[model samples]
Target: MPLQPSSAGTWLRAVLLAGVVVLLVSLIVAIILGASALTGGKQESSPKMLKWKDRGTTRNLQEVILGRCYSYVTAHYPELRDKDCLKIWESLKHAFIYKNPCNITAEDYQPLMELASHPIPCNKSLFWSKTNDLVHRYTKSNHNFLTLEDTLLGYMADRISWCGDPSAPGINYESCPKRSECESNPSSVFWKKASKMFAEAACGVVQVMLNGSVETGAFRSSSIFGSIEISNLNPDKVSAVQIWLMHDIGGPQSESCSGHSIKRLKGVLEERNFKITCEENHRPVQLLQCVNNPDHADCRLCSSNVETP
Candidate 1:
């Protein structure tokens, strides 16, 4: 079957065209399969990667930090106007990023602490335990005292939660470990470190507002105030530790100036060679609490209690 040269050439061209079509089809199939695999992986991993243990890592963490930093330097703390917010954020990031949520230590936040530190004026420090709301209210109204939360180091992250992961995205947006779950969690570590610094810097006469209504008494050996702040206080700089035992207006007073806990606190201070003073229902703070409960007996003026004929 000898064929013409032109016919043989046409037959060869048909075979080449068929081979090209097969190669193109195989390439398209491979691309589709690869894309599908990537998408499926992302779908399978989304929840686990983002899951949290309690309230997840705070959303918009970077934005919130930057905003707070700028606001602090520009408004709340004009003295810190020269601070680099970006650098502060970077310091915070490096401390916890790619680290296990349960393993972050107080030392990890040292860089951030240094970046945000400022001198707390003497005699203006106000420490509190179990009286968060009232203590803050007293500070706002008095303007003569400042709590740790009022300072630059605490102001930037107060009332917010945040944590990191050892994986990609770095931060877990689902939840962070509770303080009880991980004592060394990022938030807990930060406050412990911050509280220590605040206590150490306090000088002259300092105030501590404690809740007298706490059943366990006003002072606890485990509290930040008792544990971190108390140990860090310098007797040479501090003339006295003024303790204000405040109870809710018209509320049951479970503890007092002479309660077992108060005596223990006194012992600690005396052992440390620092003068201590205790005042139950400190007048100034009591007056502030009475603003909303003017009718309460505790809020009534002593003169109004005079016996009638």
Candidate 2:
């Protein structure tokens, strides 16, 4: 199924509504705006996806940030499920990163994602090819290895939220016995806790998806939300991850699950320093991996304007 975005003003609102999938793009879009010191009085809606002058260095910094974050998550995955953390971080990442592969644009922002400001020894084979060697050497997949679940742990509610009045609403609960368990008016503590997990998972998945194929900033987020087998649950209560994915792929404004995906895409773009001559039709990018033939020295040069030959 396809996912959608939330009309809600902020990414946080999307979570509260339990919407997921689109967060990947939303987050990337959000960060494009959030990270900036000035939007020229413009709101977070239209973020300028710009590359830094030392794009290569910034790319490396992003990689480092992702690496540290991923390491932290693997170390604490067990702890996350038992408590809170995992879900929120997942939602956070999803809200900002992951995106559809086709919309990926190297035209605008490829240089900044490099491991160095001046590109030294960066081989994008594993990230771009998805081959066995890369998988074995860099986790089962670049997406999983590069991102960390650390952020998900950030949004845990201290108390378990429960809906007391018990009523039915448009949305169904997968696990809760009564609609009141997840009612809207006051909302439920029980539902809130569950929503937290769903939101976090969504966010985490989004981030991972972003880094998975093309966007090498963190690890990678995949378009795996569609393949996730969540049929075993009740139709009523939605899972946190599921909710996040659904909202992410299908937004509040969207009619159904039909939209772009975050599969095999890259967000890496050259920073401002590099001269970027993009095609007429270009979208903001999230990763930056490339396929190439090893014999050519030109392939190694980061400043080589044209696509690798």
Candidate 3:
């Protein structure tokens, strides 16, 4: 026989129906949360997109070139005004823009070089091989001496790598060919052209700071100083080449005035009819090194000797 529903049975059926609804709602909420978690994980792992306008390479090129130009002109070259700085930037840009960076040669920078060229005072020029830091410090301390980097163009571009991509609209900040990777890379070409100009301008008793610690001979023929500067020095213009052989105070004095490398350098100068003079452990450079390390034995020796090259 069919059974009639009681109040208790009816209540039990209603309770079961409510429980199913609640469980379904809970499962839907959990699935939504899991999808959100997965999306967040993907976002965190993905690389960020860089906007073209916000590229650091382009911004740095503009700011540093412009700022350095202003400071350099104001301090050393009063003849150049603000307009000249803008011209310099424009000229520099013309060298590699719309061209393959690796294909750029020293000839490509001729326009820029011509525009940026300025006279370096006679006997004020300094050159170096494997002694960039020390030479720069020496130049900075001694107002009488100037290096290629002290000039406007070199000052703006020193220690910077820049290149352009033919396929791209602007400078390639993401990557650039290394000096060893390409013969005519933008950085190498700039320095090569600049060094040639600097060497050409050298006059009177030009100074050269060479590293005494170098095992391969301080004056390598392949170096910028040897290849570019030394070759370009006009015997008629330059009266002498003063070699400052700098050695570390601690020791390992590998190359010096009597070393084979230095002898070769002297021979090269003499062949060109240029008088050569060399001094070992050049005092000014040693003293500068000592300033940072007064406690070192070398610094103590420097104080007693107190000589200049």
Task: Give the whole-model CA lDDT for all candidates, comma-separated.
Answer: 0.86, 0.25, 0.80
lDDT of 2 by residue, 115-174 (tens): 111111111111112222322333322433321111322112112111111122211122
For every candidate, C-alpha RMSD to the true structure in Å:
5.5, 30.3, 11.2
Model 3, 18-123: lDDT tens per residue? 9999999999999888887988835344332222222224447878888888888897778865437787888888888766666888888887887778888898
TM-score per prediction, in order, is: 0.86, 0.17, 0.77
Question: Which is the winner by lDDT between candidate 1 and candidate 3?
Answer: 1
Q: Name the weakest run of 10 consecutive residues (lDDT summed) in model 3.
A: 47-56
Candidate 2 C-alpha RMSD relative to the actual structure: 30.3
User: Top model by TM-score, which number?
Assistant: 1
Stretch of 10 with least lDDT, candidate 2:
242-251
Candidate 3 Cα lDDT to native: 0.80
Tell me the tens digit of each residue's lDDT in model 1 across 1-309: 898999999999999999999999999999888887988835344434535458977788888899999998998778889999999989988998877888998889988998889988999999999999999988878878999998877888889888888877888887788887878888889999999999999999999999999888899999999999999998999998888888888788898788899989999999998888888888888888888898988888612111111
True lDDT of residue 281, candidate 3: 69
